[model samples]
Target: MTAGRSRARGVATAALLGALLSTTAGCGSSPSAESAETDGPKSTWEEPASYSYTLTSSTQVLAGTFRVAVRDGKVTEAVGADEDSRRQAHDLPGEVPTIGTLLQTLDRARSEGADTAEAGYAADGRPVRISLDWDKNSIDDEALYTISSFEPTPG
Candidate 1:
């Protein structure tokens, strides 16, 4: 074969191979493709739920709030404005804190205290609710407590 013709044939073969590989890969996952296209846009937190509450500690009086979105039963977002309060709570003598520690604390308080909070599902099975009059006075009053929560909304 002519050198020029051979080179053209090689190039064409490579292009065809690439196309075939891509198509094969795409065809292997129909459900994933449908979900990717049908689910619209993805959120950092899946099935986000929002909450607002208060945190009263020995050193500070903070209004805590947050938005938590879970996907596959795993927490995806946990943010709040009361960094001081959160830090203090984590620093408490027996507290083991983390990004999702606030929620655990709140849940514990709810279970042990007399707070009338409610939670429910929203769009796409996303849980949403609010807990008012919640208390976290375990920390000192002088500690810096801002509007803190797990997965807080931007001001």
Candidate 2:
């Protein structure tokens, strides 16, 4: 009787395990744009040689909103929209990044196995927001960028 009871309990546990696995199969969430970057068909959007956009950065080092202009793949101008942005624009102009630069940063973060690196794209496949946290356990190694009003300029 004891041997029979043990076999029955083992069978019951196996049945429960099988049922749970079957129920959870194919229940994963859909991949987001950031994860898709690592796989699947590439985005159709390409970075223009000249463009302008509004960038709102929230991070320890850069926290401000700025109107950024990129020409010939370089940041030709950056105007701060607020006091902090203006100060950062005037003092740390090198920190003001273009869309390509931001993309590169995100890529590097992903390569380095950052704790978090996610992005949201516009309908045209342009990145509208990028969130990075190099080390979730550590403080001050995070960056959040919001891009808006992007317009490609003609040469």
Candidate 3:
């Protein structure tokens, strides 16, 4: 009886230790992937009818800085800021997207349960950066956009 009781106590102690370790394993750990993602895109942000913003995009297809001008909810003009961008702009002018389009991209990524979808905003509720990675394990599936020099034109 004494030996049996000792074995039971040892098993109980081991179980307890396992439970405690499992419970505290996540303590003091960094934020999880879910928490690292920003709170999606800002819903309050409204794209102006006519606006121009510098877009620095790092993606598989469109990878360059572009000076985009939107008028009446359309990209009326897109000027490349560098040699690569100039070539891209001349070759693929239709690929240039507007701010609204970028927001939509973020929204779509989040809804589709992308591995990474984060957005940084400015003080006045403007998006400064949008990062997206559809699949964490896939290559050339990430897109980063930096928006700056935003000016709303009088329509």
lDDT of each: 0.34, 0.74, 0.76
TM-score of each model, in listed order: 0.23, 0.72, 0.74
Candidate 3 on 86-130: residue-level lDDT in tens?
Answer: 998888888899998888888999999998787767656667777
Off by over 4 Å in 2: 1-44
Question: Which residue pairs of candidate 2 clash?
Answer: none
Superior candidate under TM-score, 2 versus 3: 3
Candidate 1 yields a Cα-based lDDT of 0.34
Instruction: Name the 10 consecutive residues with the lowest summed lDDT in model 3.
Output: 31-40
* Sort by TM-score, top down from the best: 3, 2, 1
lDDT of 2 by residue, 54-100 (tens): 99886656677999999987899999998868998999898999999
Candidate 1 TM-score, C-alpha based: 0.23
State the displacement of the C-alpha of residue 51, model 3, in Å, after optimal TM-score superposition: 0.7
Tens-digit lDDT track of model 1 for 49-140: 33332333222232233333433334444344377545544444233222234334434545656233222222332222222234333212
